[model samples]
Target: MGRMGRIIISVIVILGLLALGLKGCSTTLRKAVFAKAMPGSYFAEYSRIHPSLYQVSGQVYAFEKEFARSMILRTPDGIAVFDTFDTAHMISLKQTLEQEWPQESVRWIVLSHNHLDHIRGSDVYPKAEVIGHKDINQLVADWPNVNSDIASVTREISDDQTLTFGDVTVEALYMPFSHSSTIYGFHIPSDNVVFAPDMMFVDAVPPFGFPDFYYPGYIRALDRLIAVNAEHYIPSHMDRGTRADLIAFRDMTVEFQGVVEDEYLKIDPEDFIQGIGMGDAIKSAYDRLHPKYGHLHGFDAMFVPKFGRHFGGTYLGY
Candidate 1:
């Protein structure tokens, strides 16, 4: 190759290495580090058991799979499901759907995001029309394994979109970069229920160091969810909650993030490499936030890692 061509390739290689280096310092990396030190309980990674179905008012029911939750709405034409949670969870969900309403087939599988956790196993309902945000297509190209692609999704919700069939209307509002770049928070106006994936916790603390959460977008998304005035709030990671519970969690998370951000900003950006002021930030955040949020579920468990997320976010400029 020519000298100029070699130079260009070298620059690309250097940039790629730098990107990888930065990613090594990400929340996922930190979580992994902690996991090794404090090895967590072992469980079936793909196995789901003792699935419980709760009637959330009328034809709308919530299927809680171990930890993740999916929603089912029975309509005159067919049933509509929000999120599949992977094959094992989907299989149970499908069984419950068939048992409750034998005649009605699942017509629609509305996904929360393109994340494998939420979008997997749509093939369990092959005939059902799969839908997600316009950004869903990015996974088609980005996911390395062609087999893992969300290939069933044909319908894409680009704007404030709604799917209506037999008195059930599921409105999806795209909240970009809140958690996933293309996650859609679903609101069922008639049912007064909202299915927001990983945005807010009901009474629990933020897990995995707020992984993939873009702070600014996350706050805006929380506000959007609160404004919905949903009587029932179903976060994927938690069971069910009321609008009051959702508001409480939202306020706590916002305040925690704000304090962490302020503490981190106290340090100069250039001196971040040494992390000289990090100890003070941690102390200040703990002192200011612990009194208010300590009683919340999993607060003691997730306190340290969750608070450090903002500093990591700041360093990464997310």
Candidate 2:
């Protein structure tokens, strides 16, 4: 064969290899996108026990109680428990701890927020030092007819702080006005897990309108959580979640917010109430996003009335 013929054969071989490589790359990308879009339901094996315990990582375990969840970290120093539920639930958790790991002592009690449901059982762990955001004290002080002793017990934390015990490090990040002004999230670097209470919901949609939530701040908090890049993301209310779950929730929230804002902008503020009542405005937003998010739990029944209407009103200044 001539020199030119050999060169042409070499070029053809290179082209064939390039096409094969591109085919493999395309297949991998498609699989990744499909997995992200259709994540498996993590709540399929959700525990029903009052205070069920599941190991989330080597030294980290999750204590779940129906809708409320907490984290238990076992370190060389001792054990750190986060967010004790109501009094009765706390008792059950304590009993479980005693039964399973009698040698382990509760050295620290961490609060995700000052919400009553999350902090009511703090008193149960008498020996443990309670930790929470500094604003938690002020929230307790403002409450009427409630015991002020909680403020006295809590050791306030700043915007960002870390508690180290042996090889384990737990970082608490304060996210103001996310769920509430006093909320914070806990990140455990060793376990690659983040405990975010009320910051994001997994396997379910938020009620119609996020009552008492600062919408923009909530989105920011969610963004912050995603940036942590944790392997497992656990929300207080529901099951164990992955990074994909959090991203999905964030995308849905941003989409829903856009729908509400777009609808509100189309209407004049002066005739807002007269043109479309709060309920109708909420319905409009819900209708727009339903096809994309209709599969989420509470999309039709709870989310529209409880969260959507309130969210629309906030945007419309109603």
Candidate 3:
């Protein structure tokens, strides 16, 4: 072989290597673009503003609007609503309902929990029978300033109440200490879907600002929901999920708790919040978990500060 032959071979090898590198870079860019397109990212805010209706299965429909979601089940008798959005959006929701199901009246309004966002619009459905956990009456009674007419007609449901409307059977199970002490989950046997509010946010980490979390009970509730083996799961705030997503969420929660607890143990219990500092502790825990969960939406900008304060406060008994 001559020197010219060797030079040509070297050039070919370099070009081949460059092609492979470009291909790898392109693949990575595509992945990053897809991740941003998914829920919980910046794109979510735009997608959430416009109310969208999705048919889960048969007569069951999921209505999502700007970080809040609700479900509707239609039967020959009437329509049953899982949760009404905030009171301000009640008019739009009502209009959508009327346009979608003109003849059917909303006969039942079921509250997933006592949270104002999920229940404040109950009065919009005047003729509907409002159903909720017995604790909701007290929650409403405590808030006399809020003009909620649903409280007056709200019927208390037992822990294991099953509501049957035609072919649909919705089982409302009491899941205490998960999101709130009074929170409950709705299981639809026909659709094989479970609607659990505020317990899990699909495709995204839980929000940072709201800190009402009972770690132990939240794990137990997730375990129970997973055991149900539903084909589809609907959370209050985000997109629909699957059993795998629930498992992922549970695993993430357990892993995060372990990391935070381990870090918290490093500092003196008396000085955990003050001396070590809440922000520093949170950043430390986040740094350890970032290798695994850094890709999750809100891990950096939203979750770190809120999780730090909440976990630090819990550790310090504040």
Candidate 4:
């Protein structure tokens, strides 16, 4: 081979190797996406907020921003908690509840899902009826880390099950898995308030990774929520929002789905690693909503991998 030709060949080989190395570095397993700890910020701010409750009529109270868990107490009956906090947070929440209404007892500890942070405080309400989606029951029964204390009172709730305690009515709706396999979105029909955890997540767009895996279902779940026509919405993570917030979330998910569908139609999955590919609609929606509603700390890390997964799984079901 000629000297010039040999050098050109070597250059191409070097470039190929460099590209492969860069690709390897960006994959999901590389720990490329992670959120930083706020260090007492969430708790401190939450504590100062002084949990506010909105009575949606008929013994139903929407407890706003309280100790990790927001509750709905049915006066003259018992209390039903939406989502409980971590172990320590649960204890604190219980104490706060007692301080506010010492006479009332938490009769039912209903979970949005079996995610650790949400159900960590299950031990607090000893006699309370622990309720969740059937999947949640499976998760606990098959959990790698089972807390015996919390498992005793657990009960699996079917889709569209209604729990009525005196004047209060809490409805559980089954939502497809996004963060965890077993998840449910709760709705209060009387108050037109929906208690959706990660599905209608209030904080951070949720740890979205696989579009084909579970995100499409996430979008569908929102569609169902919109069908509810709930006037008021309570999210698990961030602050309570007006109907506009729910609309925005629904719109964003649609835009996100559109981007995934477009890419799936236009490109080969293998080319996904070439670069970031967001369509005009997706980019516009994300750019507008992210600053105010997005989880800034998590976006930089989680979005790319999530995109990558969505790319690969475009045709393949997750």
Best by TM-score: 1
Q: Score candidate 2 by lDDT.
A: 0.72
Name the runs in model 1 displaced over 4 angstroms.
1-49, 145-151, 268-273, 315-317
Candidate 1 lDDT over residue span 1-318, tens digit each: 346844754565455445546653566655544444341321232134358888886767888876688888878888788888778888888888778778879888888887777777778887788888777767656766743524557887776787786688878888876887778888888888888788767667766576878888888898899899877888776546777877887788778878988988898767667768887888788789867776665565466678778778776777
Tens-digit lDDT string for candidate 4 (1-318): 346744754565455445546664555422322122122333343465455556654555665544343656565677777777565656666776788789988888877777766776677777888877776655666766654435433677766778776576777777765556667777777766776676554433445452324766777777777778887666676556655677776675565556666655654446644643444424554455446544432443345455556545555654
lDDT of each: 0.74, 0.72, 0.72, 0.60
- Give per-model TM-scores: 0.80, 0.78, 0.78, 0.70
lDDT of 4: 0.60
Misplaced by over 4 Å in model 4 are: 1-58, 62-69, 146-149, 176-181, 208-213, 268-298
Of candidate 1, the 10-residue stretch with the lowest lDDT total is: 37-46
Cα TM-score of candidate 3? 0.78
**What is the Å distance of residue 92 in model 3 from its true position?**
2.3
Candidate 2, residues 113-228, lDDT tens digits: the string is 87766777778878888888877767766675764224234578778888775568888888876787788888998889988888767757764355657777888999999999
